[model samples]
Target: MYKILAVDDEIEILKVIDEFLTQAGFMVKIAQDAEAGLEILAKEKPDLLILDMRMPGIGGEGLLRELSRKKIDIPAIILTGYARTDAGLGFVKKDSLKILVKPVNLSILLETVNECLRGKRDGQTKDPDC
Candidate 1:
């Protein structure tokens, strides 16, 4: 099973994702914030990351930039309740970054995760072209 790390400040959001992804046959890890998420990234090297753009400590954009700087190329999907403009859409404009607006559809999220994993397996060097 693929390993996925979900980082969100909201406990309910993290719990929901952990439960849903677990039911989908993934090994899901939950991080309360970006700092914990980065720690998990270093130790777990998860196949995918699900992030929330807004959080108390280091936000999702900062985390993404840090990961890129560290050359950690794991695929990430950003979920946020904030408007795209307010959240600074530029950080996630990269092809590899998938942004899901809040109240995300679980089915869509699952499908996106599967697609990303498949792309990784097929040796697709670039991020999702969509």
Candidate 2:
């Protein structure tokens, strides 16, 4: 099973993601904030990261920037209700995948997650729909 690390400040959101991914046959890990997410990233090396764009400290963008600095190429799906604002742009890079708004559609999220994992397995560098 593909491992996933999902980070969000809201425990409810993390819980929702955990339940959904687990039902989809993934090994799911949850982090309540970015720092915890990073720690988990270093240790777990999940195949994918589902991150909330806004958090109390070192938000999703910060984590992704750190990942880039570390040369880690983990696939990611960023959730933001911000509508592509400048704050949300901090994490955009060549490998940008899906950026879902808050209250994400479960089916779309699932499709994107599956696509990301499949691309990883197929040796694709970027998600075509991005």
**lDDT on C-alpha atoms for all candidate structures:** 0.83, 0.83
Question: Per-residue lDDT tens digits of candidate 1, residues 33-111?
Answer: 9999999999998998999988887788789878978878877888988657234645443666777888999999998
**Which portions of model 1 show Cα errors greater than 4 Å?**
85-93, 125-127
What TM-score, to 2 decimals, does candidate 1 have? 0.88
| Candidate 2 residue spans exceeding 4 A from truth | 85-92, 123-130
Q: Write candidate 2's Cα lDDT for 40-112 as tens digits.
A: 9999989888998789899887888889888787778988887783454554564555678888988898988
Clashes of 1: 0
Worst 10 residues of 2 by lDDT: 85-94
